[model samples]
Target: MKFGYLSISINFARQIPMLNPTTGEIALFHALLDLKNIDMNFPSTTGKKKTWADGFDPTSATLQLYSGLSANGIVKAREKLKALGFIDFKSRGRRKSTIYKLLDLGSDKSAFNSSDNSVDISSDISGDNSSDNSSDNSVTLIKTKQDKTNTNNTSEKSQATPHEQKKKFSADSVEYRLAMYLFGKIKQNNPQHKDLTESQEQKWADHIRLMIERDNRTPQQIKNMIDWSQADSFWRQNILSTAKLRKQYDTMAPKANSEWQTQQPRKRVYE
Candidate 1:
């Protein structure tokens, strides 16, 4: 994709048609919003000591469906936006979504603000001189995103207390309680799991949050899995964590059913 001295805004979404060349530029701006913090992933642009996830972009299939554009058109448009520094893109391998970041868009700002609820294209970019800063603009784009990434990390640290530990779920929350309960069971079964370190607690807490927030598993479903997994001797050995529970849910259910069905029928007390 050619990186150019083009400045495009989201409000340009209105005056342009999808088939028009300008529409892809505007639509590419919207795609950045999808790379937000989902429960499953959080990708950051830069950080050496601390590992942070980069933002996630929706698949080309999804972008095409939403924007009424062909797949190639979406890729071409996305590349154009990347060229301009209005967006940042990071590939996370084939299985995971690509990450995107909307740069901080500093006061030398080229990004369009849709929150104002206006669609006026700025006169500055409307002319032929917009390309004058292409080289500088491209460099500024990644630098700003990297700066924003660092700032966000700093802000997170400032806001958190020792008690917070980046664990946003309350101690009283069902997810937290579920994590504790599961951990307690794991401890009961294995002598090695007895002492609960802070790291272990935090790790399971993340998995619990993933199950509740990302997987959309209901509290009742989690409760059922806990009960059933513990009751079955085989699963008591296998289903050790919430992460494992979610990963094995489909397989576990059928096995549980089959375990019950093939068991020796108890002498009927009263059917």
Candidate 2:
């Protein structure tokens, strides 16, 4: 699908780490951000009720097309962003488009503020506020995302406190067990693996819960896939996180099944 140019604020670009969004969340947020820009340029004629004054109501299909996320991924990302206070929404009724508003990241700099909201490719963003810093404005947020990825291993838990590790959940719960199972396999591969913080554990459990309740994968199947992937020479390193496993589940499933078939000894022909 063709996409028009996107204008992202330089200040907002720098605050991404503070947002700490997942890949899907970031993608959906950018799509919405772009839509907000478009709306500011040519707003809806339906009258700006306070309920949706600064909001943009895009169809789910439009979001999927623009964000490159599946319908389910968009739903999950929307919920996550709402919880994070980066965005808010109002339901318009069943089968109708939902109105979504991007909240100010923090401080006085509202992303879509009426006074400063402009779509000039040169002056707004990706160009320059002044002549000399044109190249600096040219630095894409993609590079910043890449830099965050590279540094994740060192800084992933630096933001979490030691007390957060003391947060508890039901040990007998299937979600927690599945999360711990994945964490155990990770620790087997690397003995020094750190324990999950509260949020990490909750996120991992939620992914596993969705695998069961949403994806229709049984607990046994998930366990089998976990074992198979962790034993494989290549996937062992790559499938270190529950989110990664969930993202790659379909691709890994067939290979895992084939490997399982090969590893099983053939039945004897005769007694």
Task: Output the number of the lDDT-best candidate.
Answer: 2
Candidates in order have lDDT scores of 0.46, 0.57
- Measured over all alpha carbons after superposition, the RMSD of each candidate to the real structure, in angstroms, is 22.9, 18.8
Tens digits of per-residue lDDT, candidate 1, 143-180, equal 01123345543243212245545766544455555666
* Cα distance off (Å), candidate 1, residue 27: 61
Q: Model 2, range 1-271, lDDT digits (tens) per residue?
A: 0011221222233345456567688778768876665455442477541211266689989999889999889889989987876677877886999988776543344434433333232232222222432332221110001122455342343222455444454554556666776776666456456767877877777777666645555554565577668768999889987778776777786666555556543522111
- Estimate the lDDT of model 2: 0.57
Which residue pairs collide, candidate 1? 42-53, 43-53, 43-54, 44-53, 44-54, 55-99
